[model samples]
Target: MKKVLSIVLALAMCLSLAACAQNPKESTEPSDSVKPTEEAGIYTPGTYTATARGHEDGVQVTVTVDANSITDVTLDVSKETESIGGAAADKLKSQIMDAQSAEIDGVSGATETSNAVKMALQDCLNQAMGVSSDEKTPVADGTYSGTAPSFGLTSQMTCEVTFEGGKMTDIQVTEESDSATGEWFASAQELFIPRVLESQSLAVDAITGATTSSNGIRNCVAAAIDAAGGDSSQWYTEIPKKTDTVKLEGYDVIVVGMGGSGVLSYCAAAEQGATVFGIEAAGKIGGDSVCTYGPMAINSQYLKDLYNNGEDYINADDVYNTWMEYVGSDEKADVIHEAVYNSGSALDYYVDNFGFEFEGMGLLGSFVVPEWTKLWCVYSADDDNTSWNILGPNKTFQFTRALETANAMNEKNEYMTELTATSLIFDDDGKVIGVNAQYYDGTTYEIYGKTVILATGGFLGNDDMMNEYLGSTVSTIGDTVNDGTGIQMGISAGGATYMMGTLPMVHISQVPHLIRTDDLTADQKAILTALALTTDQKMITTEGNVWGNENQSGTEDEGITVEIVYAPDYMYYVVYSQEDIDNIRTNGLTEAQANATSQFLSQGGTLPAAGTPVEDIDQILQVGEEYQNVIKADSIADLAAAIGCDESNLTEALGGVDTTYYAVICDSYAYATVGGLDVDVNMNVLREDGTPIENLFAVGQDSEGVCNADGKAYTPWGGQAQSWTFVSGQIAGTQAAAVAAAAE
Candidate 1:
């Protein structure tokens, strides 16, 4: 019986083992050697965040996960360029969340931002999964070369980079075709390369006033690093070395800047037998004046002669009252009076001394009076009608002639180009005696004089000043030379500044050359083409507001002023159709419109011919389809989508016009600006206490209490600011010369 029981037990155990082997689910105990697949959804549920180096700074990201799937993703991209890297982050976040994985394709135009997002996501996933962060792949240390496309010129910039111990050591521009490009690169490199080496990352602050060159350098360095297989790490940045200073003395008058006022002041002082010295920040002489049309004079000999010959004449008192009412201030009435009375003489000086000639009187506004038209003293060249035309008809003729005269005068008086005035030197008696300047070679100089003229123009080039004063990011369309250095110096030397928080000389048209055809994408081309087509259209802020022909009435100024003040966000839109285009082509656009059309054609855009019927509107359609700020929609709802406004609101604003196509326009360009250091009737820089700062004078846009006294309106065609440049400069120069002569 015992033997039989043992045999049965052995058979039962064998059967059980076979059954367990056949059906794995039947097994009760778990196997320790087996591994789970990724599909098992093994992850801790929580939110995790990480930061990675990006194009211009750190890109921080947060990721939320539920079990194994990504629930949400957010990014902190304040440091990224809004147009490029910021757009990338927005797109990449959606893609990563949808994919629920870190592995994803990068944004086409924003590769650095894409990589940064990927790395940050990987780190967050590693944290959430309780896994160690993967180390960056090490790169071999060696020298590498790369090149970046040019911006202003027709050539590329080549850069040589050296690496030490898998880290970037040095970066240098080996070849650059354009001299201006080379200088911009050098300026950008001074700030960018050192920061890259210290941070061990491509992210760095772009050099101010040289963003394109700075980005070029960064891209070139990035390419070289990729070629040499380099990775980023945290490192220390080094401080830049300072340049040495030199002292120069023995001048009666020192004029800072070489703009309209600066040149005029120098000439006026030299004529008074004062030893004058001129300092210019740029290589050239003309400042913002080189971009102007002509000057305004209330009672010039030319205008008086026309009036005597039975032409309509404007009363000086009427002009004065109009200006005073416009500026909303009679506090500087004496200064205004002087400008109105002496403006003609100042123009006479330029015409008699520099061979300047007036082509014809130009009507500044839609006003029909011959007197108002006579205010615009258009200059003429000897041979070429286009010689004076830089951006507009007869715009730069006066300035060009002034530049020639200034150069000739420089042969007798001392003048230094590329020497930027840094500060005013004051004596124990609180009088400005000289100026401190810095040359492009990094060497500083102390220039002594009995009198100093602050003609540094407006501060549009300085972003900090603009933000502090203008309350918004205003685009500068003129030359980038007016940096407000003289204004700052005057303030530091006990002078006062005024009317800073005011509207600049804003223009209706888009910034010239902002869109280049060769570099434009299809969407960009379409939007720009639409903009070009609507350039000459009569723009209206609200529906039902009609503007007549260019010379319809004297109400154009009032209309434009009201439009600018009432337009939302200081923006307006142009309304037109195929019919308007045909009309414009038939009647022919004004000189300004023709110039804009010519410019558009030069940028590789096409225009419809006269009497042409509506054909392809693809380019026009593309504007609403692509751009966020612009709109080109057939319905109000679609237009609202493009402009980010309520459909009802937009429809109401458009006066219930829901069928026609519409495009919004805003203040796209800033030509110049007014308001800087406060000045008296004599153009002498004044202190906050209303006392004149002896031996220091401010002129042109550098002097306050001139143009835009009301701080909201501007006289577009009267050459108000240009006229002030001549009148104020004459007064300041004459006063400065007198002071120097008395001292001698």
Candidate 2:
């Protein structure tokens, strides 16, 4: 009888809908019924209020339903505007009446409100369908235990659950870091309260700093009731036994350099399970990379082909044409370009898999129009080849995808450590096998592995090697370090060399010999220390004098130590008198006082020489010929004549100088050296015969000749050692690993 009634009712409703087309207003809508004032004694459709907390402004909503139809919806509390929740609420309310079930779609812009409405509707619908208030939640009243894993480390946990009428009411989170991580536990408790009471679920996202804590709590709670037979896997999954320690081995592949390229290769080999090691005589890691200030050109034919289709101008339309610009007729540069272009793949792999952050390295002036400064260059964040630079949203030119590929191999694997490689151990066949390391012990240890990588850094510390390899004062140009440790080592063992000729300069700009960094700002350093291309020649200085190497008047002292180069930080000052020294050390005193103070001078510029009177500056200059002050000169005319500067330009430049500023600058300042290393395609050290030695490599500023086909150009400075250290190190590391793995 009820089935028949349902069919009859459905037909009658259809017939009514057809008849209503004749008079649309004749339909009996629920709101059109006789309005009834609220009478306490009378029965009316129950109005349920839904509320959501933790929102920025808080939220409240009410819906009135009559029979199986929604009468009205009102928002009593809200902080959102029409563009957000307001607009969505309007659309949602209109569809609520027609939704026969709780499977209605949510509003577009109002996700939170939509969810709230869905839950509210679910509640109201249950009552309407007569589902009774006897529904029950899952109970957690048993014991559970499990292991939490991360970073190849596993922690254990156990919990006993208690429940109230089939609903979980309490939970406890314990961990090894509990004593020292109380604050993290407090914050975690705050977040966990909602998941248990509101959502009635225990699974949650891991907390940022308190990852271990959050995971511990979740795993314990999740496993508790499951061990009571709720779900077996929830309590204990068949997890594999973890590996905690790695054993040492004999290296099979050996590398002998630690420059940008060398380190990159070595790191690669190490990643491949090679007992990778780098040998650098320098105290620091960055070699020529630290001292360089420019970038290299890497061209990908395929990417260029794709770029040309767009509005951007790329060199890929013609491979030979693009090749001529960077490589010219020299096939070696082409080989270098091919190697570099492909290298991006590996870099991309490294950044995505490892924890590397890339800021997009691409052409700087390629897309810049003379009239428009809005868009300058093309940069990109292309883990999946979609995102771009914050400034230029178009594309990227240089691709580090090469490194990315190698890094991805360990997507489910782990690396043991990131120790700085110090030296490589080689075998008789010239193949690298292992390393001797300055491991945390501060003493050398013979680490036996299958492969050895030489990314120990460059000879930024070997001054003689720089002069001998590049045939110039490459050492005096940029970093005092950049000595050619890699080159010397590689050459001693037979390696090819190329591009090792001129010491690049930042132009012929005359920079200060010594600077006081304590007072100078960054902009001041850029201007004073950078190269000046407009000029041709530069002045040299030695120990505050024109003849720093030796005073002719005092006889040869230090063999003409005229090293007119930039200071480490370009801020070297001298102070005297305890009060003045303490003033600088303790407080600023005052702006005027600070500006007027001497940063690179004592009470007097010079002292009495032998029996000369201290008050007479001229007399002291003549008598103090043996001291560093002998090189000091008051005017550019004296400086030019003393240091072999052109007399005419000296007078002009000196005239342009504000005497006060020039006096301070000439007396104390900083200088920057732009050029140094030169290398062949494979980065091997060349013998005097022009051929590379077997199984030898050099990287960083150890040897000149990486750039400048015609002459000297700026080096890729700063993290130069850092960039190549990882890149070349990785390669060497991987090769070493392969060798080791193969030997094993």
Candidate 3:
């Protein structure tokens, strides 16, 4: 009887619609039986509310329908991320109202939020239509395939999904090309795929730091679900409770962090017959140390071998003097001597004990004193792609060595990852005892040890700490995991801080020039085009000073560092001629430009054909022809007008470029920071009164005084910092173990 009634109602609605279409003018007239407040239609006039899950939380929506059409839609998006998900809700609400339908295009970069809105609207519409809430119409169980648009040069991300009993049974994402070298995609897949299969929903939270790749997988899965005709409302999954607990206890020494210093400390303690444990806040072990290219060493067997082979080698005395100069004369000579003298022995210990090897030695210096290359160090392993070697010159090679050391000591040492050390546990006497840690799943644990080593690295990842210590104008391009938790713990335990005013490694404008060409105007782009055609020109400041290679400067030296002069208005140019352009076309870009261009290309960014031997200059010119910053003009006055600069300034700065073309350049960026806990030569943390804290030690970036040897933190040479990481770790580890043994 109910089915018959539904059929009759449906027929009546169709007749009403036909009548309205036939007499549009009459339909607009007020009907006596219909309420004056409502539009003329067959829909039941009422308001309906529905809720749907979103990326981070839930979205509730209310809809008002007047007979035939939706009159209004209100969204409650209190649970969404303020910037991204909140903006999506605001924009999508207007779009849905304008279209007068629940189905609408999603906002780019906010796909999860947009889908939540759509699902909420669908629920409201179904309620208004008097659809049975429990109506279970199963989609045909089958395999479905779909693809999402690529982010870059990579292929469109494709997915194959299998449905069983109207539920998602399995999903397989194809190995597609990714400009991030598959890291982001791999992380997203590892985190998102399992959740999608369990909850059968595409509204899962995006991966914390890999949102782009997470969205790609979500879009692909949504496409497959649409193909399978699956009902999205039924795909909701219950969120799990966080009740998992892990307890660990009774160790002689506990090292907080599994970075270069942490791993070395653990190994050293274990070698001394002391039971040691290590913990890392990140899911993986390697911290910022994994990202280092190489370490600094002085008077090592590697350097001796190089010297014996008649290669340029630095003397120990020169290295010591240069370091002292870099640190300033008033710096602690004893600390400096300790690090310099033991650096070679530390390297030897690691090589002899862990089978670590050095490929060769190299130099790094500051731009203020370009001639002094006091920083020299051994690189690990060969650059050649060969068999699976434990260490290499690659930035991540140290991580490999650390992981190997951890594995080798698995019998005697225990380690846990994804556990954050929140605070230090102290006895009644104010002596350091252990740490208070919390797991990723909300479970807390108290880990105790006789001696505690703080190898938690620097606070580069904490923007508040960086702004407070390094100044607000400073920026960072370092590891995101070094949040200074260990430093905070040390300070809470009455440890003094040191070297808080050091200069972090910084460079100007490392991003590819052409990547931002979309912000340029046609005239400016044309200048860049002409400049790309030129060759054999070095990048220089407007004052004709060398702008490149500013890394060779001495400590605290004031000059035009690359980072200081990388402003867009500073206006740099590559002075070149048509003949140089022809030569470049025949021989390709200079080695420096080629290397830079190659790095940009590897990241899936487009570049001008200026580096290639092409006959048509149009192709090269067209590369950044749309960017406004690449200003070009036939005359100095026109060029000034294009760049919005004074003609006199332009004329004076670029006098020789009247018959030639010049291309504007910007800064390159790279960053690392120093400054941490105050420590003695034994790596024992010290109080504000200069008394050593009992059983407390700091190493690696956690030890603040390492880079402050000369009173200035802005030391030339990357090797000094790298070498200190290892040397401090060895010192802290050995001393910490001895302290633990003495206590026993």
Candidate 4:
């Protein structure tokens, strides 16, 4: 009797294991279509919970099952992006319950969080079905493709992953958006792909300046892993970091940050015969400077003779006086003089010595005071420069070429990327010496030198610093690696800051969380950009008050007082009625569509002709609604409710809406903070009492404020920031080399 019982029990166990081996389904039908509990019996009556990795941390799901039915479902997606992922939680839960299984349609814009929720919910259902949860589901050997959002809202990064012997052997980016900067994306793909393959894990740190790209790769891989019958949560094993120290001594000058300014500094010091060492936090060399048009030059003789009839583009003396007047005082007259008069010579020095190139001289005139002397020129972006984009020309290769020349000049002149400088090293008597840095792979470095140059860009990437100093946080188009490390190091060495509250460089404006340019066809982008940029109709703030006529979205201004800068959070909504939408789809866009349209949108395609109907306007609006960028309603009160504004305020703003209405979101973007460490004309870091730190220097955005004033926008002349990189870099590099030579 005992033997017979044992055989029966063993057979039952085998059947259970076989059932668990079958692939789990997310959902097959909507909740309303699911059969009643008595007709479709699958689960044991109980509650189960599971968690999976999400955009931030983990998404949790608790599923309550009755015998043959899913009774209730709850989720915690708070760790995801509030506007995108978090907002999709309720819809995801409803779909799971309705299907009475794990399979369901995912929310459109929240792919990452939706996947996590589905994975977690499926695990819960598996648990309630009496399956073992100790080990992960085995991944089948196959190649799979998946996609997730990249930098642009409309664009997604598609990845193809191959699995063999239950291991991810190969991964490749099959499709990506052009809206993402080429340099940053290349850096992300180079470093992140290898790390993921070696560890076979998703818990890797994002590339410092290419975080969105790194996350896009990770999320898309997770989707592929799910498709291959693997438990993605199991592959999220964390990577370990080393905690060891390495030291080096005897360098003449150490430059922190290998951006435009730092590269120039390295070149200047190397030409002066100094053994220079450079440390950059990002995977590439150029920082925000690569994304700029060009520098301001008052009288660059090389440019004058090349572009003009051997005459300076603008008067240097006149510029000096105008700049002084704009700043309101001569508190730092010598530094302003160098910024004005030395600007042309600095441009010449780089062209002659460093292999830098510039072409096309003309106007990048200030928007603040339109008549304030046009002094800027554009960098050369010939056919060989494939990195050029509509936002800015590709000058990153020029920096790379200059660095190559500097490296050739001196064997000891070297720079390391993926290495971040943390603090300044000092001697016993308190003179700045070198820098303490850490490699991305967790190696510590204590590099010693006779002099140090702080050129780590500015604090735009640091949220805490931006909020504390600039009064509020703003969107940035520059590299996110400029987190004020250099400025903090300067303060650690008793250096003072100047004009820390000065306005950031705001230039472009677009729809908030814009659809990636590559995701849409040319015609779609044109129609969308036209609708978002149009201010001809009534525009309203978040509070539902009518916008001022002069508050055009792209027009630059001082402070946040006027223009799109004045909009709360630098965002507003353009209101349109059903008649307008009908006219757009029927008669075509009117002249009103051209009023405030962005020239940058030309990258997409030309705006449709006035009074020519756009055949796809309705489809375009549907896509906009899916991304939560467009809100539509049948009544004014309903529209107000969708926008989270008082009905009365909206009614007043729109003059009592009588038809269906739509609101399109618009936002302004900035480059970086212009304020930084105080420095003299020689680019020497200054103490609070107005004395220079003997062996220390500052350059680029790290000390560009000497040319501007607090409580105002950066010297509105376009490319002024890039010009400072050239001017201050030459001064600091040569001055630091002199100091090192004197010490030796």
Candidate 5:
């Protein structure tokens, strides 16, 4: 009887729709005698709420369903990335309503959040259909393959899962990208993959500094679980953490970081017979250093013999003079002198004793002046590629070699990963002693040592500290785990800071959440890259104002860095028209004007050749729209409305918009923070009153400001920061080792 009534109701509804269409002006409201059918539609009319795992936390979806259609949908993706996932709410909601079902093409760039919304909405719709909620899906005993977005939003990390007797037996990552630091990704694979299998859960903590890769692996497993007919959410079982305390003592020197600087410090201290304890907040040893190309060297024997026939490639005297001139002051002249003169010698010492090697000499991406000396040298890698393999992945193995060499020098020398230094330990006279740290699993550690070196890379990862010091925050490509604990520890020990508000190392610009090369073909990626970099058309900031030299806040007179750093939201948009698209399809991109290279976007593809027409121009635009990196409209008014800006301002910026228009977004990313704790020539932390903290030292980004000025650009050389690590780390380690010996 129920089935017969459902069929009759469906036939009557079709007839009523036909009658309404025939009589256009007829009232469609039901009469009093024709009562509306209750509980007869496919779906039980009600709102349903469901939750699914997002990039970081649970994404809640509330869906309203009427008797026959999806009435409305809403999402709460607050825990996702603000500019990426969080920005896709409206689009996702609109997609759900338009499809009238959970079947929807998700937004690009925010793939994780989009997938979560789809899964949660599907659950809600299933509830509306009166599906049994008490029953759980059984996992089929078979192997399955799945994928998820990894480091790059558009890149995929694939994994194969084996299921036996309704339990996951093994998982093997079939493919992964090295866009995230290679060492960090390896660390994630080494630690994260096994924990999931051991716990039989997806709630394991992500490896520090390798969160993206860890999440990628977890999501891949979750996808495999779903494919095997099991509820992925059921595996998000919480794991308990132990709250215990541990104490470690008898170390002569403690290094509170394991990146380029901290590793060098440990090696230098260990060479001096000082027992060293190294603490790293990340899962791996190399932090931002793993992603860097190389470091600056003056007249290192390798560069001198290979490039300039053993004499000096460049004079040290000129470097020191130019360095002082760049800062426009002699405030930290002593430290600057040490940085310039000792850079080569420090690198030589590491090469001779610590097994470090530099293959060739070249210029860095962020050089100050074209005519200046090519002081930077590339770190040697296994395979030779462009620029002496310095920019390749194998260069990170050099740090590994250094750490191994250091450990062999002293049996007591040790390093711990996933341990973060919380604060400095002080003695009765308020003198710095050791450090207080916390393990990732909630264990407390109190480590004592005679001297401490602060080298936690800068505080670019700390939002509050960035706001407190630099007054603004930018997208960082550096390790987000390198908070300001080292600098704060220095300050707690009466150490002052130098140029705390200096500009960051902002060198690269691309579309927000850059789509990886694997996601787009060479031609499509070339077109997108061209759209982002083309200055042929008028460009405007997020606020609808024309972007020009007048908007630059950089202290540098001329450079792309200044323009990008000062742009609104650190981004701008290039407006194109239907005519522009037609031109691109017919003729070609303004190849010369559009060839500005963004290393991140051009990783695995080449830009279209000049005058080579891009036939897939429209397809590329569609992709840009999907990624929310492009805005398309039919008129100037629509463009303004879409961009959320005033039409008048946009008109003034672009003169006028005619026909359909597309606005392509361009965003900037930074490497790390520039300024940090003040230090003396010997790399000892200095108090506000110009006195040195006897047992405290700062290096790398923590003391980088000693060579830079606030409000001005970083010492425009790319390898300068890496060079400082060697110089400052060596000086600090040697000085601290001497202090420890004297105390004994």
Candidate 6:
């Protein structure tokens, strides 16, 4: 139960307790279509006893009503669970007054409770709305147990209904999912006894979305009626409201993940002057921002800010244009326009006060953006050279600046702890208040806070996750260290999911060894070795047939593709030699043929590995069977054939290779996949019906990745590790803060 509440609250996207413009016929025909024969105005609203309980304890409620609305409501049961039900109770009363049943909005903290209450009320309303109360047969009115399915998931509950002389005079306590709202729902039993006794029959409502609890409660009543063997249910009845609240321990805000987005959210909240606690999922503090290589793409106004002391900085428009040119995709949303138009001052504020870096050299200024995005810069391997450090002549400084800003915020907020937030806890009112952290030693530490921002780096950090969701049967080409634990936990909890397929992390490294031992195709191996000589180039698709567009579904697998880095031999199991790789890095090789001569000496030993002399290759230490996945070819087409690519495109791209861009490509790094997730602009995780989860918010990778297109791509986009981590985190933290503050 502890695990469910904490984890489920964060990942609460599965439930759709609220309905908007829904087709009522989807459930049942509306009873309201029939006309009331006995002047409906003369009917006096009656009280209906109700019992709602968790699997453990049950609560009783005495609900009193007049006419069509509830007048007085009281909870006669519930002890330990009362504190968490305030919001649910308030919303329940409000809903009964203005709206009756399934037509109401979902309660945040008391989601299940509100739904159950609505259903209980609907049971009575359905009867009152019926044209002939006597014609309404008793479909259910007893102590019965059943399971209700919602969001493709199911929950179980128990119900007890009572009927005496035809009308329902009493209701008994039963089970509910919201262990907290037990008293409020159960209290209806007492106040409703008189009405149930007087009426000939009564109709009741079922909980909205919580059909299980609703059915359980009604079944309890039904069982009581069946025990009496009477046809009951024809009077008006209502459920009580929740009015108490439960608050968590210290701190106003808790931010999950610590990469760029997490940092930004923390900084923003701290800037707004709130006491905040920053939580991370990994053992380290830096999510993905710290590992970035270059400045992020910015708009023109940002460029204007850096011009003040122009010794070095970047231009925002350039970032946009460069991205469009390189990625050759049209998805960029005119960041230049927004930055140039509305974000000038904001850009200046970030740059001047936060020390945000801006790069303007190399393609850093003229760089092209990929059609896809994950959250990092795509270029800048030259930074390792003497010419590209933060202050170097060729280097522009945006990445370091952002990190500086985050650290500064941390410094200012001494109370903040960088704990990994494994789970989130929400009060019954449907507001987030606390979180759980699992330490490296496998111990879990609980943190109670007002709000939390998820900035955990994307799923790229976890090896297991990569294989589970991504293609990791082979070595992962990107940052092997990126695992994305925070994102996984966040998603599993209902925080919502997004952005997983950004830059494709080539999954196999020692693939060749897997041939007989692990299973790989011949062509899959040769292409890998052939491409091994270039920069960080990943074979994402084979002629665009298998993965149409870019793995939007992450379902299809065409021919094999490889993610090869530009080492002496492309990023491969074995480069002939470090010097040979250096030669490719320096652009000194005469021809592709010339390069193949010593391929054997460059990397792994013989066939037991191919291309190299067995003795010379064997000299290098090796373990399992021969390296089998490596590829070798004299021409691009041959190479293309081996790697499962468009032979024609490879031939063309190789004919007149751009030495400047292709030179010395280092390996790539992947933080998480950013693809499809159902969400709204407010960063709210929504049901297919478009209603928000009360306390649920998502930030960082799992949440962000879902919104982006599948097979998203990023190039050395700085913070590629935590690209969306910064922005998405800001949205979650701020909103979570708003919800918490409102709850308080």
Clashing residue pairs, backbone N/CA/C < 3 A, model 1: 327-710
Question: So what's the TM-score on candidate 4?
Answer: 0.80
Report how far residue 394 has shifted in candidate 4, in Å. 3.0
TM, every model: 0.60, 0.39, 0.65, 0.80, 0.83, 0.42
Which TM-score value belongs to model 2?
Answer: 0.39
lDDT of 1 by residue, 411-520 (tens): 54678776878888888977788898887556899999999998988887765676677654444544556878988988888889877755676644442223321234
Query: lDDT by residue for model 6 over 648-739, one digit each (tens)?
Result: 66545454332211111122223244432334544555554556654555554545444233443433333322334434544555676676
Residue range with the least summed lDDT across 10 consecutive positions in model 3: 1-10
> What lDDT score is found at residue 608 in candidate 6?
26
Candidate 3 stretches greater than 4 Å from native: 1-238, 302-312, 362-412, 473-478, 511-602, 609-668, 709-714
Candidate 5 per-residue lDDT, tens place, 116-165, comes to 67667766765665544443457899999777767743346889999998
* Error at 348, model 4, angstroms: 1.6
- After superposition on all CA atoms, how large is the RMSD of candidate 1? 15.3
Q: List the candidates ranked by lDDT, beginning with the highest.
A: 5, 4, 1, 3, 6, 2
RMSD of each: 15.3, 28.6, 10.6, 8.3, 8.6, 24.0
- lDDT tens per residue, model 2, 1-744: 011101101222222222222211222222223333333211135676644320112345566665434566665335432223554666656656665333445443233344344444444433433323243224445433433221111123334455555555666544333212122333345554445544445433333323334444554554454443342111212123323323245444444443345545644654664444344433223233332222222232222234433233323323224434432345355433433343334444444444333332343332212221111112333457553211122111121233344335444211112222444557787654455544221334455544333333344334354345433332122223233434444544455545443233322222222121112223322222221111111223322232222323221321111122232111111211223223323442233322232221111122122222223222322222211222344555655555454656555543433221121122221112222333345544446676653234444334323432332232211122223333334443454455457666
Residue 497 accuracy (lDDT) in model 1: 84
Model 2 scores a C-alpha lDDT of 0.35
| Candidate with the greatest TM-score versus the true structure | 5
Cα error, residue 510 of model 3, in Å, equals: 3.4
**Stretches of model 4 off by over 4 angstroms after superposition:** 1-144, 152-155, 179-181, 226-233, 363-374, 382-387, 425-433, 517-522, 550-562, 582-586, 594-607, 613-622, 632-652, 656-661
Scored by Cα lDDT, where does model 5 land? 0.76
Clash count, predicted structure 5: 0
For each of the candidates, give the backbone clash count. Answer: 1, 128, 26, 8, 0, 164
Off by over 4 Å in 1: 1-242, 298-317, 354-371, 382-412, 427-430, 511-513, 519-569, 573-606, 609-616, 619-664
lDDT of 3 by residue, 1-744 (tens): 011101111222222222222222234421334332334343456999987755545688899986677899998877664434665676778877886666566554344566667767766766665543444335568988756543322244677888898778888887454323322344467767887887666656555334445656666666666566544443444445466555566788899987778877777777677788888876555565544445666667655665436443456676677768766664467777877777777877777665566655534453454543544544553356342211223333445565466556646577777677888888898877888887655678788889999988777666578667765323233335567887888898889988876655554333123321122333333334334322346544444444344423342354434433232222345544445556666765554444343212133333343356535443444343322223345666665565455667666666546644434444333345577898888888889999998799988888855557422334554456667767887887788889888988
